[model samples]
Target: MASSADDVFTAICGGTFVYPAVMHEQYQDIRVTNRDGVTLGSIREITYGHAISRMVSRATEEITRIDHTSRTIESRFKPNALSTFNEFIGSDLLRDPSEVVGQNL
Candidate 1:
């Protein structure tokens, strides 16, 4: 069995969210936190031109889902922008379980 921490990581591996502010364009971001709300680190689709392209390409594939297609912000808004690039990707990542097996004993 996987520990709670493991579960959390697996859940956020390739998750999706709707950003209404960004024209409702689907996006993905990695946010790691503990029970105390201490964030470990986070990586959003936003990528930089100076950044590694190989890493960005691989990450792009991992974050977006194949089912519900979403426009990658990088491809749409700033395709030629001399800045970081953002990809669209999402999956079942870091979501609360549908049901709890048990309660406080």
Candidate 2:
């Protein structure tokens, strides 16, 4: 039975002819072939780890963009609604209406 790392490596390599080496220093043993079955390159053992990190970084960037866009839209609309309400009720509407009711107790 293959280990989890072996499965991950196989999936990334996309072939059954390759094998994962026990020694991390032997990363060069993992062969990568081109479509024409020619040796292209050998990825270092750290390559997979780097790939995963890059994916996480991209996801975080997209999330930040979404959050910033949402806040900008909210800021633009909130002031418009407040201004419209103030205009409808007169600029002094923000003041206490109790003064007009004659209840200065």
Candidate 3:
């Protein structure tokens, strides 16, 4: 294990509603060991990059879905929904998780 990448990925996939609980459960099973059967490190780096990439992909999908839904709603009924969707798509908080994953091995 290298970093808490798996936790981050789980959080993203589960969405805002369930990520917190799933992350806590996953964290409990994380561990590290060496060749001699000795505990060397306890970081969660085993799937960091994969997790980050998954998060980025999922975020992109979510943004796309929101954009489509907003456009449909605006064209058919409500205009105010566009503003909310735009705000969510434009927010700086939803960043690519891959950038946070370390590259050095």
List where candidate 3 sits over 4 angstroms from the true fold.
1-30, 33-45, 56-99, 102-105
Q: In terms of TM-score, how similar is model 2 to the real structure?
A: 0.14
Better of 2 and 3 by lDDT: 3
Model 1 TM-score, all chains together: 0.17
RMSD of each: 16.7, 28.4, 18.8
Give Cα distance to truth, residue 54, candidate 3, Å: 3.4
Clashes of 1: 15
User: How well does candidate 3 score on lDDT at residue 86?
Assistant: 11
Candidates in order, TM-scores: namely 0.17, 0.14, 0.14
User: Which candidate has the top score in lDDT?
Assistant: 1
- Per-residue alpha-carbon lDDT of model 2 for 1-105, expressed as tens digits? 112334534443343322221223212112222221111222221111111111100000001111233322101101111211111111223334232111121
Model 3 reaches what TM-score against the true structure? Answer: 0.14
Write down the lDDT of every candidate, Cα atoms only: 0.25, 0.21, 0.22
lDDT of 2 at 88: 15
Model 3, residue pairs in steric clash: 1-45, 2-45
Superior candidate under TM-score, 1 versus 3: 1
Quote the positional error of residue 58 for candidate 3 in Å.
16
Error of 2 at 68 (Å): 35
